[model samples]
Target: MNSHLLNGHYQILKLLNDREDGKTYLVEDVNFPDSQFIVKQLRPPSSNPQTLTILRRLFASKAATLEKLGQKNDKIQKLIAYFEENEEFYIVQEFISGNPLTDEIIQGQPLSEDQVITLLLEILEILVIVHSYGVIHRDIKPANIIRRESDKKLALVNVGTFNEAITNTVDNLEYMPIEQVNGNLKYNSDIYALGMVAIAALKGLPAKEISNLRSQKNQLTGEIVWDNKNLKVNRKLAKIINRMVRFDYRKRYQYATEVLNDLKKLINVEDDQQKQHHKKLLLVLTGVVGCIILGVGAWQLRSPKPGSDAELKLYQEGVNKYDAGNYEGAVEDFNQAIKLDPQNALAYNKRGDAYYRLGDYEQAQADSSQALLLNPQDANAYFDRGFAFSQLGKYKEAIADYNQAIKLNSKNGYAYYGRGLALAQLKDNKGAIRDFSKAIALKPRYTEAYLQRGIVRRRLKLRQAAIQDFDTVIKIDPSDAKAYYQRGLTQSINKQKYVALKDYTEAININPKYIEAYLNRGDLYSDLGDNVEATENYNTILKIDPKFIPAYIHRAIHRFSFGNYQGAIEDYTTALKLDPNNITAYNNRGNAYLELGNKKAANQDYSQAIAINPNNALAYYNRGVIRSKQKNKQGAIADFQKAAKLFQQQGEQDSYQDAQKEIAILQHNLAPAPTTRPKSNNY
Candidate 1:
């Protein structure tokens, strides 16, 4: 126990901290210099060897879970290694270099409302992932949140469910909701703690002080007294925070995503600027600004807010269905709403959003365009159309529409977000980053903007910077499987194959239908010569989606590499069936048949490929070899000559030379070969 080295590997450098659950140390791997890792000594409650052994195994399993969660996200601390030594469990994890958020929060310097929103969004995003794993972080406080120095983003440390102490009384009672103290903890308990954190930061007071201040007021009242504290928060955000910390658990946000969505809405241009920024200006310059405001309202009134009661009910139902993730039901309800209220431009815009979610970009574009025609000043409609155009790969058109949306409502962060996506598609990475940064500045919790910016940064070869952006995205929405998959790709590029594999596996676990993750993992396995695993992944893709052409082609290539000629031929044939004019499929299938010594079949496939694209030099070369093997000397000579010419024209010098050699052999075989040999020896 007194040895500096643990298990003959980790050399203790310094003690980080100690708690009731475990003692943490910053350690260095004796095997890996210039590497730092966190080591925790987990002490079992019982001193019995058997109990300790059982706990070690359980701890190992938990380590795997922690590793998976960490790989799928950047905000979570990554478990690197774990082992049992001296009847005590030792867990190693990656060290994050950052200061605690508590340290960043000064007593007299409360964070701005925007900063509060950003902080809550970041924490809620991580909580969503944590809760999905059925793990409750009973300790939600500023100290647990680290302002990571690498990216200046928030990273949640020491996810609590890994330790039994989390279920006990929380170390910081000030952050604990009343229900949790009563031993009735739920997901909303975390929400309550986050709300308290927000209030504490805004009030520039300790959580205990704020709670004590609130406890003196009427507990039965539904109104939050903090709202009356004259804290600098918008009404909408205040309403959300109030609901989050409500005395009644049922009144709090039921889920982290619910809180996140409301926080995003609070920063929306329509909600923030229209209501908060211009309120006093509109009152003071009522005559001038009122007309502009009236025009905006009139555009909205094209749908008539007081329309047929039944129609309005249907529209509200559609909105509710959309919010509940029932896109198909929402579409039906929206259709009914449109039928009942034909002049509803808002209905058209909402329906367009529904279509966009369903991946029907054409229909979405049409609906959004119709809405714009009905109300030319509708920024939401323009934004919707821009999103549709971006999805359709018409980046320039999308950029134009986004420009119009931004012109109409300059404060629209989402329009900036849409424009950034289009600019990214247009190959303007710098422009895309600018717009994305702007969007993030205006809407601090804009997860998609962070994601797209990460992609652009990765494309620009800013690996660490890109990773930081992806980390922010994960911190904003942990359930985003795409973010994990993308981070896996970046890790793979960085030569962290093992870490990348864990990331891809986590992504697949989160979304079993994620074909791209499977395909990428299969490709990585194939590159590493783990053909069995690669084939299994490809098989899984086929099972999930038999019509997926890439799976068939990739599987065929894998089979061909392993000398499974017939299997490769069958897979390539399936690919050809899915895409009749697939040139690569025909050529590859022909090569597979040639490998199996089927000259006739191989010749037919080569001929089909050449017919599809006459300039295919490989097809010509392949057909020439088949003819030469068939003993058809005249046909072989003719085909070889044609192949040699085509290969030369295609700048394939080696292929051309090989074809020329075949032609000379065919000609000599057709003529009298013995006579030519004798003449060459004499010369």
Candidate 2:
């Protein structure tokens, strides 16, 4: 069909989309040439008069609601008019000069956590007003949300309530909550739709695809496996979004206002955290000082005081400097305080902390030991000493000191956290997890503990639990790029390729200098058979970190797979330059050389590999083949014998047999060939 005028006033400029239910078009108003608008033509299910009457009533009601809604909110698209043309309904809405949310979304890729939050906040702000008017945006998907180019603000378009009158309206099924299908549409149903939209945009996948990615299914809990796809979402924001999209509408936010209120709280919390960071540091110093005083023994009141006024003043200054991140200055102040009052344990402990911050584990340990000597039961000194030991790679000593600290103060979260790190270093994952759990119980917002525990969980192959842990870290600190990157690793291992890719992308988006994220993303792209995209990612990695050996090796492998022998050789050579002792690199480079018919070069690489690892049967076999081709029968036989012995020792029976056959062929060739040629001529 051709583009035509709608209602003899709006001329269809082009068809925007053609769906089962209707056709959406960009149009110009003939009455006002400067005005551009969207015209949607919908056909009722049937030509029956009764159906037409019901459709007309529903359309008229929705149009009127839109016009009023648009009048109240600039973010909502304005309804200009609606009319019946022939037997179809034509609705005109103000055109928005922007791209749909889906336009920037690449399937299996994700937007940054902050970007997604910003999008949700803008959409929810508008939804709060729409829901207050008892309107449910029956359709909430990426395509329905326009991100305006002018102000970069998101606009909610195509507002229509799908109640009993339009219950059968075809819509994006992926975004539809269960309640909508059950005809139990509530205001929260819109919240569910919005949550799905966020998920779709974050995963760079459509709602339908996201819906299928759900691995957790229960009456009260419906969570997609891709929910933690490496986006460092704030914990509160993640929880809020999860609740918003609950399968049971009753579990979701009952009103858009409810979600808006929570988002407002998140915004305020984030703003306060950003704006009052210095204030928080001062508060921390004050709190730590108060704790130290309260925890001191009655010996402090004895004559010839443990600390003089001058010492106390210097100690306080040291603490202030420490809080301000001036570790060297803090250390100097602590030294002066200690000189003035040798018995001041707090001064020694604070100095130890400054030393630790400066990466001087030796001085930190000495200061902490002196603090412990002055105050035998000081938990802070034990904890500080434990931290120093842990940093020095003395896991056993760290564990011992952490135990002492915990014994002195059972509620010390840092002690437990420190013990957990020590245990992790010792490969005691269970012990580490217990300590981490204790730390988390004492401090609910312990991001480091959560991150470490997540890493341990991943190591233990408790992948789902690991994901939950990373999710918590993200919630506590949305800007934790490492959390997102780690979560992506788990997702990749879980075989969620696209979801893993999205997570890696989110990590890179948060931290542009994240080389590992780029490498993982490139690998995922290669596995997905998009070599071009994969090469681009590898190129990006090289651009960011040219000295990265793995990038060169991986790109070389990629080049080799596609018959690019020269490129593969170049990459392999670069990788070898970065890591000269890499056995795999030498072997791979040899193979690439062999492919290019550089037998002498191939022989040198194979010899180098064998020299590095004499048990490398494959390398010996390769060298034997090259020697045989060069007519060096004796050298070929020696190499084959070595290859056979090594392969047999390594339990590679087939390889061992191949090497034996090659040896036998060489031996046969070395024996009475003249007699065999005479017998063949006689025959």
Candidate 3:
């Protein structure tokens, strides 16, 4: 507690922090006045006996490894000296002058994407060296990463050691075999700890609770919860982190070198993007120079240059109109430009964009192809051609052209976003997400990228994240009916019926012709038992799209709830007529027929429903009821027994009990009648 020497040499200056494992103190070396150091006490007597022994052994081994590691990398903090006093061991190590990464993240100043990638790659390199020496950093987390203030160089601290605060605690201890525990103190455990550290850094939260993270029901994979808003991570980097932090160890990168390789690839990608941007700028500058030369040549050759100048003016006007979203007017001006200057590649590209906007794929493709023929290096022409291909559902060709456009101009966010959409159509979710993220990196306000990324996230079952993306989309474009509709669907999946209904209603308000919204809203109403509103919405959908199967299904349910058995049967029958494999319709129709005393028709419908879906337990129950009513007591009992078994298999205890009751009733009814008729006949 004083500014005095401890254990013969370390001059204790001030206490930094203390944990269950040991205490950290700012200290100075007695041998060198200018030398500063940190003294860490390992396995203080206050720790548990078992943990003390483990730490004593671990530290003795780590000290030897650290001595060797220090010689390999100057950044590796040197263990200067060590000694023991009063049953507590202290280690003197080089004092790092910097703040912990933990403080930065906790203070709401997370590292940028570039900084994160660099830090991770450096740590991975250090880890590869440590592992090669048969040492592992069993506890890897933000607190162990130190950023030097003067050089801005990040160094991994406290390597080849466990954070006794985590592993030395006896409470809630998970016992492992001695061999496994020892193995866990080696490289495999180091990999696990590194993954946890990566996740914590990217998500700005502790990764120890990753097992409890929500996933789709029955899914073995855990969802990655990267706080991109907080960390400012690009999509590509987030993906790399996700793969690293996989809950299943087998799915994660087996070695630190593999993770480092991925980081190197990302670095290369960033470099390539920069080079492409430079090339595009050079090309644009060349185009400007060419235009100036052409202007000079025309000025020298023409006696009257009015007509040529007018053509150039009209072409510029057409480009402006196209940029302003006036596709029809842009097309008109483009025609005039072509009449004045038929060989203008810029005019052709602008006209192609206009045609693409008008949904004229053939004309768009022709004009874009012409533009490309005239100027093969034109990025805009490639983009236009890609758009046309995407419109025609030729995703492969669209992707190829988009690749070409990106090669010519990597800063073209539009091309990246378009390629993302095409990839999504092809069901390449990871690729699509990467492209969308790149688009977002280039254009922060890109609503379409957010919307498309949200859809892909939902497909990946990252529901909460998908909701956030949709929220961003709605914030950007308030009248986006599809955004509202998709958000409502996500809410419904999350089982928030009222919230889903509100979203669906908003969608309908934005675009009344959104038939899916009407149907979905009706379904939500039906789920909430608002049959009247459900029926009204269903009716609206049917009026809009007469062949809508869901509307018929909902109307049938509404009728069934209101005791309109015949009407319910008619509606269900109509739904099934439109779609023969509509199992729900068949089941509902069977129930309606059973209520209306049509036993034969009810049985047939139930059989068809069962044929469509072998797991339709309700159909079995309905058939059992029909058999009971027909006085075939033995057959009734058999059917009820089967129904009860099926219900039990499905974990429907109440339905199983109902079937059991029917079985009991049928068995009782099948008992022999009393024999008392002989006396009356004799009289």
Which candidate achieves the best TM-score against the true structure? 1
Residues 1-683 of candidate 2 have per-residue lDDT tens digits of: 34566787787788888877678898888889878898887767787889888888987887777778888677888888888977788778888899998887778678877788788878877876576455778888888899898898899988865233443674567777776777677877778888877777766786557657554455354454445646666667778888888766776777665676677667766763453344334434544565588785423311124447787688778876776568999999988987877876667777888899899999999999986775565677788899899989999999999999899789988899999999999999999999999999999998889999999999999999999999988665555678889999999999999999978876775566789998889888887888999999899989988999888888887787778989988988988888887777777788788778898898899899888988877778878887887789999889889989998998989778888878888898864222110000000
Which sections of candidate 1 miss by over 4 Å? 1-311, 324-342, 358-360, 391-395, 423-445, 453-479, 490-499, 573-583, 611-618, 631-683
TM-score of each: 0.58, 0.52, 0.42
Two-way TM-score contest, 1 vs 3, winner? 1
TM-score of 1: 0.58
Question: What is the overall TM-score of model 3 with all chains considered together?
Answer: 0.42
Tens-digit lDDT string for candidate 3 (299-414): 11111135588886787687657655589999999899888766666678778878988999989999999877766777877888998999999999999999999998899998
Per model, state how many residue pairs clash: 0, 2, 0
lDDT of 1 by residue, 97-156 (tens): 999877867777788887888899888878777776656777788888899999999988
**RMSD of candidates 1 onward, in order:** 11.1, 18.3, 20.9
Worst 10 residues of 2 by lDDT: 674-683
Compute the lDDT of residue 450 as modeled in candidate 2. 94
Error of 3 at 184 (Å): 77
Clashing pairs in 1: none
